[model samples]
Target: MGLNSAMATVPTKEKGSDEIDFVRWFSQLEGNLAETLNGVLLRAARPVQVGAASGAQNLASTSAGRLVGWSLREATGTAPGVVRIWDGRDNGGALLACVNLGQGASETQWMAPGGVSFQHGLYVEIITGAGLSDDVEGAVYLGGAE
Candidate 1:
């Protein structure tokens, strides 16, 4: 048997021209790529306060984005409650998170490093114990898109 025939061959996919160009462009850029990306991300980050409503409140009505972080606090400082964050308009769509606050002047904060993606928007439903205020005070950090 020939030495060439005795050797094994492996197939590999070739990189496209666009990908090659992108790599070259990225390499030519000044400063750290991570730092550049971080700066862009920081500029896109936005904070919106949740309305003090007893029922559902529309936090953000954007086309596409994500929920980066959120903080909730009891308004009246009387009882415990829960804040259900939705990934759509009004109370519709998937539930992103449920933050529960303790009784008598409580607060809760949560964060998703990668962010919770949302296509429609964001909504929050506040539920409190009986004889307690349904009002809540907090803000949600929105990232991605406008």
Candidate 2:
């Protein structure tokens, strides 16, 4: 028997597409005093929300990129603990868009197709109660396969 044949190896597969998985997280800080700190992200195909107490996540396709995971826990607070995402690249700086949730207090939608005329740098700010400050957290994710 030859000793050269005793070595073992694991085969690796290559990605068929030039796709990559990426992710980022932000947190609501301890004492974040928001009645609802929206996590707005700009998508081109409207993402989907998951679970209760949380908001829509993602429904994205790479205009030229992959759909990674999420980037959460960048803040801390009362934590509305919601994440509402959308498409068309205009969810404010908000990790998630509030408009998509639809009618927390309305019979009709606030807008059509895309809500709130999103600008290039419309910052997604928090909406907490008066005279209170706490922390909150959330994340964004990206992923695609070949």
Candidate 3:
């Protein structure tokens, strides 16, 4: 038997090319090469306040992008709860993901399997179980090309 090896190759563009040509050339590269080269990375984190009942609230108004990771913290609560993320201003939109929190003061974190992108806005909803306080707070992290 014989073993063979293959090497990756990157396409090159001529100097003095137009911006569009440069972009097109970069777009042909594999993986995140183009995004890294173009500096089109994003990372954002913001705190969220839980409502008194099951309700949706606008966590952050972001441009079109993907949510990479998130976290929730029960700053002042003793009851287990559930946190949900949405793709719109309220719970009336699509649900992106949800994280479950245990009883007592604690924090929960989650990351998208392959990153979740939203075409509209980003919202969050918090639902506490019975006998649990609603004074929960936490932060969310988002990342994308925009």
Global lDDT of each model?
Answer: 0.64, 0.30, 0.57
User: Which parts of model 1 have CA positions greater than 4 angstroms off?
Assistant: 1-44, 53-57, 105-112, 128-132, 144-146
State the lDDT of candidate 3 residue by residue for 1-146, as single tens digits: 53243333445476544333444445544334312424543223333344442453445544445666665656455567677788877777788887776665556564554477776777777775575545556566555333
Q: Which one is best on TM-score?
A: 1
Task: Order the candidate numbers by lDDT, best to worst.
Answer: 1, 3, 2
lDDT for residue 36 in candidate 3, whole number 0-100: 41
Name the 10 consecutive residues with the lowest summed lDDT in model 3. 40-49
> TM-scores across all candidates?
0.59, 0.24, 0.55
In candidate 2, how many Å is residue 117 off? 23
Q: Write the per-residue lDDT of candidate 1 for residues 55-143, one digit (tens) a residue.
A: 42455644557678877777766677678888877677888888877764555454555687888878877765675557777778776
Which regions in candidate 3 have their CA more than 4 angstroms from the true location?
1-57, 105-114
User: Tens digits of per-residue lDDT for model 2 on 87-145?
Assistant: 34444333435421111211112232333332222222223344322222333332211
Q: List the residue pairs that clash in candidate 3.
A: none
Residue pairs clashing in model 1 are none
Model 1: how far residue 29 lies from native, Å: 18
